[model samples]
Target: MTNINTEVVLRKLLDNIAKEHNYNDPNVSVRAITTDGASYSSMLYAATISTPNKEELQLFAKVANVGEIARSQLLLPLFDIERFAYKELLPAYEKIQDRNKLSNKDRLVWPKFYGCNPNLYEETVVLENLKTKGYVAYDRLKSIDWAYASKAVESLAKFHALSIAYGEENPTQYAELLAKMKFNPDSLNKMAGTFDKLVDMAVAVTKEDNKERLRQYILKESGFKNIDKFYQSTGLIILSHGDYKPSNLMHKTNKDGSIDVIPVDYQTISANSPIKDLYYLIFTGSDEEFRRHHYEQLIDHYYQQLCRALRNLNLDPEKHYPKKNYEKDLKDFMPFGLVLGVLALPVITVEAENAPSLQDENGLNSILTTKTSNLYPERLNGIVNDYVRWGIL
Candidate 1:
């Protein structure tokens, strides 16, 4: 969007906030507006504004991409997913917590949603500017240490547990929001086709043995079936943050070196198995050794926290979400991580210079093309080795 267009959006955002808060101050105005970056898909703006009391309010706003809304007919409605999350799901989670009597410090941590505008497929969500609060994303190029990884697992468990508690309370309403959202099968097929091209490109660079292995594992007709199956898997379904990679999570280090994890970008949430999000976070953020040592431990920690969360909500975890059942689902869903890695690692490892332009209308194909980063092949090899060790092949 041009500078003028951005200013117009900010004006609309201010109006939305004022209307929501019932503030009718004529003097309230945006004094300054600065964009975060253009490389990211969302158009992010940081605004400094004067409120009715002459108080300064610093806010962060994420405006959905106009390109995706215009070109991709299937993705046009995807914006509503995030808006629904902030508007509906988050509030519901908090209500459950309030009933459970969780302390303010123990509550789920996320950006405070001021309000939203989902008009004409141009979704705009106004939220807290966590940057001013000392939150930032971990460096994607580096592996996460145990301190951060443990916190992440525990944090994710808390979020997923809310799903179970919510489902128990409103069994029929667990997936109510997602039931109304659209998921085009054509987009899934197109996504598979794009991954096929990516694997073919990767085959040229892979070792002979590993090349055919990846091809047979990822390029066969079953590849599409597996992808479809993941999308359809609803067993033990609950609300999930669809994209749980490091870039989507924020953290901070205090003077004592303790860390805080706060999640952002609720766009990919679904009423699917919670393991999907955990798998995405592990595969995309960590390496083989990290998983080799901590994978089982992390999984255990997640379930423990899940039980605690269920109890906090006054539900029996053993009955609502059993440990044996959760373990079985984790194992059954492990292969899906490989499928996700094939699609995610490429985008994750792509250097800025080689990264695809968002201007490209071809969607995932634009980002799935061959990469110049040697890290890509190393990461791919590690993931393949993991699948083999886990006997997931």
Candidate 2:
């Protein structure tokens, strides 16, 4: 986007914020606004909300509006999904918990929702600035340690449990909310050119014998043939955070050395097999040693918390979601991660200099050309080898 257009977008966003929070008061304005990683698809702004009394509030604004190119490529109205997650779905879940008398500790995963404008065309959601409280993303190039990985999955458990609780309590409303979650199975088509580019990069870096299998994996319709169905898991479905990468997570290290994980980025969320979230996080976030040695432990950890959450919501875990079902679903849904891994590895491993400026017309093209770190191939290799060993390839 040109500088003039960018400023205009930001200005309209500010106006939205003022209207919602400040009664459109001229006495309130912004001191400064800046962009970050989300500037590609969403306009992320951090600023000081100034009032006539010199009092100020630190806030973050996430805005999404598609141009012609973006509408065709991304395919869905992302702002609508996020707005529904914050405005409707979550609130309903919270209400279910309130009637069950669950405390804050029992219902803790998401951020504080401030306000949102799901205007169909121009969408903006304002939130409390967690940055002001010292929250930050772990280095994207670095693999999360056991501590970080554990907290990250813990949050995922809490999030998925909310959906189950809501569904169990009010089946009708849960069905309605799921209906609003829009998806296009063929939307994956737009990524064809880029997926091919990523495959070439993966093939180039991979060891020889694995290269053919990798190509077949990309070419095979079997791999993603049932993706939309798996994403909309028929029997054991829950709300899966669609893009659950380390970059989408925020953490703040505490005095005791353990970190507090706060999940963000609800734009791509879909109702799916809960294991889909686990696959993206474990494969893309953990190194081989952790997966080989402690992977089962991590799975057990998420289920334990999930069951505890179920009990808190007055549902029996064994009757509602047995441990055996979770184990089976984890391996069954592993194939979906293979497809997601190829797509995510590049973005996960790209450095700032090589990363695409997703704000421009040539932006999608820029992403295809981003340089991949050594980890990209290594991670891609890990997914391919795992799929073959599991007999899915």
Cα deviation at 224, candidate 2, in Å, is 5.0
The prediction achieving the highest TM-score against the true structure is 1
TM-score of each: 0.88, 0.86
Q: Candidates' lDDT values, in order?
A: 0.71, 0.71
Show how many residue pairs clash in every candidate, following the order shown: 0, 0
User: Model 1: which residue pairs collide?
Assistant: none
Candidate 1 residues 1-393, lDDT tens each?
Answer: 332355576677777676666555633444333222213456677755555565566678876554542336343355687788888888999898888889764667889888777774356788878888899877776777788987787778789878777777786665565575424456665455666776666566666667777778775533765676666564677777888878788898889988889878888776678788888888888888888899888878888877876677777888877888888888768777777667777778767567654544665456654354777777777778887787755
Assess the local accuracy of residue 77 in candidate 2 as a C-alpha lDDT between 0 and 100: 64
With candidate 1 superimposed using the best TM-score fit, by how many Å does residue 289's alpha carbon deviate from the native?
2.6
What is candidate 1's local distance difference test score? 0.71
